[model samples]
Target: MKTIKPILFFLLFFFTISCVNQKQKDQEEIKQTVKNYFNAVKANDLEKCKLLIEDSENYLGVIQGEFNFLHKNYDEINPNDVLLRNILVKDTLITFTNEKEKYVQYIIKNDKNPNNLKKPLIITFMFYKPVGYDKIFNRVILENHIGWDK
Candidate 1:
């Protein structure tokens, strides 16, 4: 009975560690994919950006509120380099909500790079809806323009 208990405990511990590692890998992948997407945007590489973003139509919601100026027909985002940092991937979704609420569903790159040491990198093209549009005024609203600290 003592031996069995030890074996069971070890198995549980092993499984827990494996799950945690997997989650960490997934997060790192998502981060890298987001980084790549932004790099492409900075270079004005529309084709590369399109490859990263999901093909689903209406990824970004309608621009009826103060964000109407941002509306344009294009797969890749054309935000200024300063605003590029506003995009991030938390978990499975690559969220771009700060500047102008947006989200995308993505897929992970299967090929692994041992040198990179960042595995399970997740990528997604997401969509988002503004929480409160009625509160905004007629003037241009530039709320939350901060970027991610390096």
Candidate 2:
């Protein structure tokens, strides 16, 4: 009985450590994905961006329109600038599966005007790993809001 107890305890401890490590790894991957996406944007590499995204068709039109607007209005636009700013992440639940998901939000200024500040732009991304999948299957560009607070 004593031997069995120790074995059970060891097994539990191993599983606990594995779960923690997996969570950390997942978070790091999500952050890396975000970084890569922004890097592609900075370089105007639409192909790279499309590769990183899951449902490209859904958001491609919006992304292209935004790019056109930025290029027309701003002399120099860098996605890296916004990436260097505040980034927030929160835990989200998938309603149908009751599975945990990640919601990442990036908040950045629209213009270069330091004196007069307007509402910041908020870009949110949702990441989900489907059941039986080892890695995140979907990285959804959930929303892109201009002149929005946090």
Candidate 3:
């Protein structure tokens, strides 16, 4: 009985370490995905962004189109002026954390677009990782709003 306890304790400790390492790896991959995704968007490369995603639509371009329209119509706006500054990520901590990691929220921020777009269009993405998957299997844009100065 005493030996069993020690064995179980070691197993649990190793499992915890493994889980942490996995989380770290996931974070790195997710960060890279974000950088690639937005860089593609900024450059208007819809195909590249689509390929980076596992199972998702090319909706980022739709948002880009809107920005383009504003840039063309408004002298104060320039889509190229939008620059991504940081990307924030947080896990949803759902019931199936182990099986899916359910949802991860990513808030992408851009440096102030002097183009009268006050918020500079904050983009939020919800990413999901499936069980036994090396990459995120699902993703959706939660929000993309460029509050106008007008």
Per-residue CA lDDT of model 2 for 96-124, tens digit only, reads: 98888786775546555565456555457
- In candidate 1, position 27 carries an lDDT of 45
Error of 3 at 136 (Å): 7.5
Please write out the lDDT profile of model 1 over residues 1-150, one tens digit for every residue: 999999999999999999999656644554455566556545556455444544312332321221232223112223354334544534233356434433333323223343443333232333222332111111222222121000
The per-model lDDT (C-alpha) reads 0.39, 0.59, 0.52
TM-score-superior candidate, 2 or 3: 2
Tell me the TM-score of each prediction against the true structure: 0.43, 0.70, 0.55
Model 3, residue 146: distance off in Å is 5.9
- Number of backbone-clashing residue pairs for each candidate, in the order shown: 14, 0, 0
Question: Clashes in model 2: which pairs?
Answer: none
Residue 12, candidate 1: C-alpha displacement in angstroms: 0.7
lDDT leader: 2
- lDDT (0-100) at residue 10 of candidate 3? 100
